[model samples]
Target: MIFEMTTQVRVSNFDEGRKWYETLLNKKPDFIPHEGFVEFELIPGCWLQIAEGKPTEGNGPLRLGVSNIESERERLIKELKIDKFEINSRPEVPVKWGTFKDPWGNHLGFFEYLDKDEEKKSIKNNLERTFN
Candidate 1:
């Protein structure tokens, strides 16, 4: 039985949407084909794809629940060279979540998480990346 599959995000312009999703997602799209399209994983179960010259409708919200929201944000800011001005301050929303956007205008935000070891490591690494 297959446990993995990919979901493609459709859009009109590959470059335009690719930049948008990448900025919000904070990782490079896993694949690109010149004028064909660019792709990123929403997770192991889903993905976002952008193609050239095609019509794009709604921009989707890509939210993540993180162990340490501030650290994750800081990592993106420092490594990506995103200035402090580029980020939305913490607790952008109630219920324990901080919100922000990717370079292309997709909504990117992180929720507070407390049960994952990888998340803890990610937060620590991200914080270290940001500061030193």
Candidate 2:
């Protein structure tokens, strides 16, 4: 059974990519296994790896769950200088989301649950898994 997972994105330049990811995540990487590679443990067992290499065009919009999509989008615009993007949702959908691209053209985005109670439950579950 699969218990953990990782997703990777490539960048053409190592230093610039590392710095951009650090700013986007708002923290230094949890692990730098070697030069030109770094990893962030996004959730307890979920990892996001950024490596130095030729980036794959149109690879991903790796959506991260957030508590507030609007605020996070605003922060990205002001801090990372990303162009303004739209947040979308449907009546049956449980979350709202928005997407943007990094300097190296890697797609990244955020999603926020419409129901606050569900959001709290998810946060609590993740915390329990992290601490247990």
| C-alpha lDDT values of all predictions | 0.59, 0.92
Winning model by lDDT: 2
Q: Which ten residues in a row have the lowest lDDT in candidate 2?
A: 72-81
Candidate 1 achieves a global lDDT of 0.59
Off by over 4 Å in 2: none
Q: Could you give candidate 2's per-residue lDDT for residues 50-129 as a string of tens digits?
A: 99998889888999999999989888888888999899999999999888888888898999999999999999998997
Candidate 1 stretches greater than 4 Å from native: 1-28, 31-36, 51-58, 83-95, 114-132
Best by TM-score: 2
N/CA/C clash count, model 1: 5
